[model samples]
Target: MRIGVPKEIKIHESRVGLTPATVRELIANGHQVMVQENAGLPIDLGNDKYREAGAQIVDTPEEIFAQADLIVKVKEPQKSEIPLLREGQVIFTYLHLAPDPIQAKGLLNSGCIAIAYETVTDKSGGLPLLAPMSEVAGRMSIQAGAHALELNQGGRGILLGGVSGVPPAQVVVIGGGVVGTNAARIAMGMEAHVTLLEKSIPRLQQLDSLYGSRLNTIFSTTDALEEYVTTADLIIGSVLIPGGAAPKLVNREMVSRMKRGSVLVDVAIDQGGCFETSKPTTLADPIFTVDEVVHYCVSNMPGAVARTSTFALNNATLPFVLALANKGYRRALTDDQYFRDGLNVYRGHLTHAAVARDLGITHTDALNALI
Candidate 1:
């Protein structure tokens, strides 16, 4: 198998699909890896390093896309890269297709087998691949929100951890999954008043047990969200629905009533955000004001911390990458139902049920599609 790693072209996205260590492992497994020139240079994994790891350094993305059987990427293929995809070629990356119909249509027309990292599951019903980045994004959400709360950043001029004379800022986290848990942990660490809301009673109880008196765990309800959101100084939206679009728990009316200078950080922005007012922002211009409330909705928050994020992501994704390389997509996917869940598109057919339902497209069972 010939695997390709392309430099991320998204604005301020410095992460690469494969690291030198990962390439070396793939080579040890008898797979040929082709990496775009300087794909890892931005993150300090230079071309010489890749060469030392037994990867062929291609000069352009076109060559990498044209020749490689399996294309591993950090982000979704951009519009320009979509045209280069060939029938039966594999694209393994984070394909947030539910909210982006253009990308979905492009993948379908290209006739490529697309596996989304975000949808892949583990035996524990966790998104193993998306977990690393989700953890990074969740932690960064608090940091970004704290910075955004500064008066100069157009925030409410409140300090996350206030001085003895002042009360600390109130931080509210929606969702108690990987993202939410991390967000609340960091917020609490910062000495801010923290509250977590979740729809799952079991999960809420679990969080309550874990945090004890340090964090307030609340059962999520329409009234609960509205009340907390309205009074929150820093609101972090970490809601997710697997491959489907994130539910809009915070509506425009709720946002309109938020206190001026307050900050809303939507860690779920990659899945179209749980906050109704969130539109994807870039690292170049990370935040914008809506209804006088600041919104930090950068779709790729982890990208800002590329070196740490890249290594973390590699650790989570390497096993799946090797599985696909060793047994080929068909055998590898068919052998593992969790891996099969990653199959969003198989040779032009939409195979992931949640994605299909979210996009209003027909879905083919992954097993049937592969056969």
Candidate 2:
């Protein structure tokens, strides 16, 4: 098998798909790995490092896309790269297709087998591949929100943790999943007043047990959201619905009532955002004001911390990458039901039910599509 790694072309995206260590492992497993020139250079993993790892360094994305059987990437294939895809070629990456019909249509027309990292599940029903990046984005939400709250940044100018005489800022985290949990933990660590709203009682109880008196765990309700959101100094929207678009929990009216200097950090922006006014922003220009509230909705928050993100992602995706390489996509996916859940598109067919339903495309069973 020939695997290709292309340098990410998204604005301010510096994360590479494969590291030198992962390339070396693929080579040792009898697979040929082609890496675009300087693909890892942004993260300090130079071409020399890839060369020493026995990877063929290609000068352009065209060469790798044209020759490699499997395309490994950190982000979704951009509009320009979509034309490079060939029939039956395998694309393994984070394909947030539900919200981006253009990308989905392109991939479907290209007749490529698309496996999304974000939808891949583990035996514990956890999103193993998406977990590492989620952890990173979750923690960074607070940091970004804090900065956005500064007066110069167009925020309310409230400090996250107040001084000895002042009261701390109110931080509200929506959702109790990986992203929300980490956000609450970091907010609490900063000595701010934190409230986490969750839809799951058991999960809330679990969080309550973990944080004890340090964090406020509330059962999510319309009224709860209305009350907390309007009063929060910094709000983190970390809601997710797997491969589907994130629910718009915060409406435009809710946002209008927020404090003038308040900040909103939507970690779920990659899945179309949980805020009604949310639009994808780049790290280059990460914030926009909606109803006087600053919104930090950068679609790729983890990309800002590329080095750590690449290594952490590699740790979770290596095994699955090797499986696809050694056993081929069919055998590897058929052998593991959890892994089969990652199959979003298979040679022109939409195979993931949630993504298909959300995108209003016809669904095909992954197993049937494999045949």
RMSD of each: 0.6, 0.6
**CA lDDT of each candidate?**
0.95, 0.97
Q: Kindly give the stretch of ten consecutive residues in candidate 2 with the minimal lDDT sum.
A: 154-163
Clash pairs for candidate 1: 156-261
Evaluate residue 238 in candidate 2 and report its C-alpha lDDT on the 0 to 100 scale: 94
| Alpha-carbon runs more than 4 Å astray in model 1 | none
Write the residue-wise lDDT of candidate 2 on 251-327 in tens digits: 99999999998999999999999999999999999999988999999999999999999999999999999999999
- Writing each residue's lDDT as its tens digit, candidate 1 over 123-184 gives 99999999999999989999999999999999989989998999999999999999999999
The 10-residue segment of model 1 with minimum total lDDT is 362-371
| Candidate 2: residue 40 Cα off by (Å) | 0.7
C-alpha TM-scores of all predictions: 0.99, 0.99
